[model samples]
Target: MPNTPTTYPAGLSRREVVAWRNGIFTIFALCGIGIASWMARTPAVKAALDVSTAEMGILIFAIAIGSILGLLLSSHLLARFGAIAVMSACFVVAPVGLVVAGLAVTLGQLYWVAFAGLAIFGVGMATCDVAMNLSGAVNERILGRTIMPVFHAFFSFGTMIGAGLGALAELLHVSIALQAGIVSAVMFAVGLLAVRMTQSETVLHVPDETDAAAPDGWRSRLAIWKDPRTLLIGLIVLGMAFAEGSANDWLSLAAVEGHGVDRPTGAVVFGIFVTAMTLGRLTGPRVLDRYGRVPVLRASAVLAALGLLIFIFVPVLWIAIVGVVLWGLGSALGFPTGMSAAADDPRTAAARVSAVATIGYCAFLVGPPLIGFLGEHFGLLHALLLVLVLIVVAGVASGSARDRTKTL
Candidate 1:
C-alpha cells in the first residue's frame, strides 16, 4: 500500500490554496519559457558558432551532462534547503545562464562560452524541475485532484509564447544576446511574484508518514532505484522525454535543414508543436480521470509512434504540420503522468521523482548527440526513426503507471 499523507497543514483558506496553485503554475510556465527561448534560437546559435551538426551535438551534450549532475544532486538539495528555496535560487540561475549563452555566441571562443553557459543553464533547469514537480505533487494531495497535467499545460503555453517571440525576433533580425537579455529580465521579474506567492503558503510543515518510516541518509534514496515498478515508470517517461526533447532540440533544425524551410518558418513549425501539446495537456486530465493511467498512456504511445512515422515519411509540408500536431498531442501526457505515478506515495515522492526524472533525462543526454551523428549520415528526418522504437518500448511499460490499487 502507498503511504499517503494522513493530514494537511491546518487552516489554509481556499483563496490561499488557489494562490499557491497559481504560483506553481507560473513557475512551471517560466521554466518552459526559458527553455523554449533557448531552443528556438538554437539554429541561430549554431550559425553564430559556425559549428557542424556533430559539433553542435557535442555542445548540446554538455547541457545534458550538467542536467544529469543536477538531477543526481536535487534530492539532497531539496531535503536540505526545501523546495521553495531551491526553486527560487535555480529560477535566478537558469535565466542568467541563458543570458550568458546568448552573449557567448558573440565571442571568439564561441564553443567554450556556449558550452559553459549551457552547462549552467542545464543544472539550473534540472534542479528547478524537481523542485516544481515536488511542489505540484504535494499540492495535488492537498487538493485531492489531478492537477499535475494542468501545471505542465501552463509550461506548454509558455513554450508557445517563447517560440512565437523567437520567431518574431528571427524575422526582425534581433541579436540573440539582446533577445535573451530581454527575456531574462521579464522572467526574473515574474519569477519574483511566483516565489512570493508560493512562500505565502503555510503547508510545508506537514510531513508524510512514509518519510518517517523510511530509513534516513543515502540508503533510502538509493533504494528507490531498486524498485522494479519505479524503474519501469522511468522507462515509460524516458520514451516521452525522447519524443518531446527531440522536438525541442531538433525540430526546427530538421525543418530548416531537411525540408529547406526558412528559419522563421521553422520556428513557426516548432510553435505549432508546442501549441498542440498545450491543447493536449489542457484536456488530458479529464481523459486520464475517466480512463485511468495505463490505457491513456498506451494510447498516447501508439499515437506518438504513428505521428513520428507520418512526419518522417511524408514529404508534403501541410501533411507534416498535421503530423506535428499528432506528435505533440501524443507526447504531452507521458512525462507529467509518469511524475504523478512516481509520486503516488507521498512519503518517497521526492526521491522517486528524482530517480524517474534522472532516468528520463537520459533521453536528452543521448537523443541530441545521437540524432546529430545520424543526421550527419541518414539525414535529420531519417534519424528521427529512432524515437519510434522508444515509443514501442514505452507502450509495453505503460502498465507500470496503473494505480497501485488497480494493479494490486
Candidate 2:
C-alpha cells in the first residue's frame, strides 16, 4: 500500500503510519481467515467428532467463552503492555490453538481437546481484536476519515479467500489437520510481520490530560458500563455481531442440512456471503458519511432481518444465495461503526472500546448454543427467526451510534 499524503502524528513518519495502517488491515484479514477456516470445515469436524447439532453448538461455545475472557482482559493488557505487544503475543497464541484443535480433531478425534484448543484460539483472537480495533481507531483519527469499514472489508476479503480454499480442500479430500497446520503457519508468520510494521503504543494511544485528576482504576473502567449511550451502542453491535457470528458458525450447516447442499457447495455459499460482506464494507464508508450512522445502522438492521427471513423461508438455492448476500451486506458495518462510536472520545477510547466489545461479544457467548438448541427443536432454518427480533432491537437503538463529536 502506498502512503497517502496526510499529516503525520508527532514522532511518526508518513511511511510508518502507512505501514501501521497496512499492518492493521493485515491483522484483521488474518483473523477473518482463521475463523472462516474453522467455519468452513465445521461439517467435517462435526462428523469426525460424531456430534449432533446441539452438541456441536456446545463445542462452538468454547470459543465464545475464550473470547469473553479475552475482551474482559483486553483493556488491562493494553494499559499494561500496549497494543503492539498484546497483538504480537496473541498472534502467536492463536495459531498454536488452531494447530492444537486440528491435531485433536484429525489425530485423536478428541472432543475435549478440540474444545480446549478452540477456547485458546478464542482468547487470543478476541484480545487481539480489541487491540487492533483500538489501533485502527487511532489510524482513523490520523487519516481523518471513516476507514474502519475498509479495515473490516479486508477481513471479509480474507474470509472469502479462506472459504474458497476450504471448499477446494473439501473437494480434494484434504485432511482438516493438514489444512489447519499450513494455514496456522502462514497466519503466525503474517501476524508477526504485521505486528512489526505497526506503530508503537505511544503513537497509537494519546492520553487525555483533562482526565488526569479523575480516579484511575477498575472502578473508572467499570463506570463506562453505566453510560446509556455505550450500552445502546453495545446493543447495536450485539445484534449485528450475532447476525454475523451466526453465519460464521452455522451458515454452511444451514446450507447443507437445511437447504440440502453438499459440503463443498455449502462452503461456496459461505464464500458468496463473505464476498457480499466485502463489497458492503468496501462501499460502506461513503454511505455512512452521507447518511450518518443512525440511519445507516437502522437501514442495515432492516436489510439483515429481511435477508434472514428470506433465507429461512425461501428454499430455492439461488434465492437463498441472494438472501445470503443481503445478510452479508447488512452485517458488514455494525461492528466497525460501533467501535468508532465507542471511541468518539479519545480520552476514554480504550476503556469504552473494551466495555462495548465485551457487551457486544456477549452475543457470541450466547448466540451459538441458543441458536443450536433452537435449531435442534425447531429446525435450523426456522430457528434463525430469533435473529430478527434482535435485529429489530438494534434498529431501535441505532440512534446511539450517532457520532457525538461531529454533527454528521
Q: Which residue ranges in model 2 land beyond 4 Å of their true spot?
A: 1-5, 43-56, 168-175, 204-215, 249-272, 309-324, 375-382
Model 1 stretches with alpha carbons more than 4 Å out: 1-9, 43-56, 106-111, 168-175, 199-216, 250-271, 312-322, 375-382, 405-408
**Residues 169-264 of candidate 2: C-alpha lDDT, one tens digit per residue:** 899999889988988998999999999998764554446531334456555666778889889999999999999989977899999999999999
Question: Counting only residues 3 or more apart in sequence or on different chains, how many pairs clash (N, Cα, C under 3 Å) in candidate 2?
Answer: 0
TM-score of 2: 0.86
Candidate with best lDDT = 2
| lDDT scores in order | 0.83, 0.86
lDDT of 2 at 135: 84
Reference-based TM-score of each model: 0.84, 0.86
| lDDT (Cα, tens digit) per residue for candidate 1, span 141-204 | 5665677899999987787778778888899999899888998887788886896677421254
